[model samples]
Structures are given as structure tokens and as C-alpha cells.
Target: MYLNSTSPTPESCEAVYPDLASAIRCVREQWCELHGYTEPFCRNGVWWVFPPNGVIPVCIRDVMNSDKGQWVRIGRVSVAILPDGSFAIAPKSTSDRTD
Candidate 1:
């Protein structure tokens, strides 16, 4: 799903899945395998916070506006995850001077 750029609370955003099974499978298979980390999977839209010793909950959102649109937003920033599971956030462009 595409992310809203003006989303208020990106960090606390909850991904709405079509069904419980899909969501659980995603947490068990995709999320864990991709991050090399595991946390308790939630079946009902419950929020989970892993301790410092555990893997941090990383929220990834699909980027749809870029020419090379294969990217995800990580903590209010855009990042490209590589095939090996490593990722790097795109640096803030100088043209973004609206502050």
C-alpha cells in the first residue's frame, strides 16, 4: 500500500491487513526473515514494542511518487532496501527548504 506523505504519526502507524492470517504470516515470514529479527506477532491490529535488546519495530511504507519508486519510508524518511535486506535512507535534498 502507498503511504500518505502528510501522515501525522508515521512511527505509530498501524498497517491494516485484509485478514489475520496474512498479517501473521507476514510478521513471521517476511518481517522476521528480512530484518533478521523477531518479535511477537499481533493478530488484531495490536501495537507491539520490542525492548531495546530486541529488534526495533521498523515500519516500512511503499513510495509511489518517485521515478524509481521502489522504496519504503523508515521513520519519516525514505529508504531503499536491498536484496540482501540492508537498507539506506535517502538524504534530505537541499531543495527541501520549506522550514
Candidate 2:
């Protein structure tokens, strides 16, 4: 899942895959297939492609169109696309702080 943001970071943000880690892993293996590194990652059981765009599974536009300032959680990790065009993800077990 993704979310819209207005915080001064990338124009959008990233997230998700329902047990798609292997798929992501496949993408990661082929980073060169895209313009640059895919920046694939897994937090808790949730997989994500950060700075997403035409290269990855999702893009900034996806976040830009989502509910702003909302957090999208997958398992123990969560993705929160801010209201200032910035986005972040953190473990649900940790502090809510995004420093």
C-alpha cells in the first residue's frame, strides 16, 4: 500500500505486497534491468520498493493520490506518507517518532 504526502521529501512514497517478497527479490536481483537500483526492502513481513516510480512496482503518483498523513501498515512495520510530500516507515513496536 502507498499514501499521499505533502511534506518536502519525494513527490510521493512507497509500500506493500501480500507475500510478494519473492517477487520483490526477483526484482532486486534485476535492479540493473531498471534505470538504477530498485531499493527493494522488507520490514517485518511487508516488502517495499522505495523512491518508487516506473522502475518499481508502484510510484509517487500512487502515494500522491492516497489519503494524506495516513499510515499504511503491513504486519509489524508501517508506512506513513506525510502531508508535506515526505514519507516514512517504522516498526509498530517502536516509538511513533519519525526523526
Candidate 3:
């Protein structure tokens, strides 16, 4: 599967995956790298958070039914599961922007 990201430079955002397992692994690795963490505390196998301390529970809207990818904020991080099955991760700034 060719999982792509939404950005001006699509070529740089694109990734190839031979299988779903490998794709999931890549997502986890990329997310960890983005946060500069050797390991991150993942919640419910979907949401990931760092530090692993005093994390208040937050409700996140289900994005499974959306045809297009939807960015959902979970505390300090934002997560989006794309239609092509790629996961997008970004830190939520104070301005509440995903970019």
C-alpha cells in the first residue's frame, strides 16, 4: 500500500508499505521519532502520549466512519487516520493548529 500524506510536498510525504503490519510499525516508529522518544506511552493501541505521567483521560471522536481523513485532538497531540490507512501525528500548538 502506498500511504500518502496531505502536504504541499506530497512526494516527500509518501511512503510505501508491503503489508498492514509493517505500515502500523512504521507509524509507531515515526510517531516516536517525531516526539524524540525512544518509547512512548500508547493509550488503547491508538492514541500515543509521552512522559507517561499524570495523563488525564480525554474523549476523542471516532474517525473510523469518515471517508476523508479527520484530525482529532487528544490532549497535546493530534492524530488522524487517513482514508488510505496511514496515520498522521503532530503536536498541537497553543493556537490549536495541526500544522
Which candidate has the top score in lDDT? 3
lDDT of 1: 0.38
Clash count, candidate 3: 0
Candidate 1, residue 41: the lDDT equals 41
Clashing residue pairs in candidate 2, if any? 4-63, 5-85, 6-83, 6-84, 6-85, 7-83, 7-84, 7-85, 8-84
**Poorest lDDT segment (10 consecutive residues) of candidate 2:** 2-11
Please give the range of 10 consecutive residues that has the lowest summed lDDT in model 1: 61-70
Compute each candidate's TM-score over C-alphas: 0.24, 0.21, 0.34
TM-score of 2: 0.21
Tens-digit per-residue lDDT, 1-99, candidate 2: 222234422323244434334333432334323434355455554444555355545342343333344443345454454322244343354476566
**lDDT leaderboard ranking:** 3, 2, 1
Candidate 2 residues lying further than 4 Å off, grouped into runs, are: 1-24, 31-37, 52-99
Q: All candidates' lDDT scores?
A: 0.38, 0.39, 0.41
lDDT of 3 by residue, 17-72 (tens): 55555555555455445434344344655543342243543222232233333343
Once model 3 is optimally superposed onto the true structure by TM-score, how far is the C-alpha of residue 30 displaced, in angstroms? 1.2
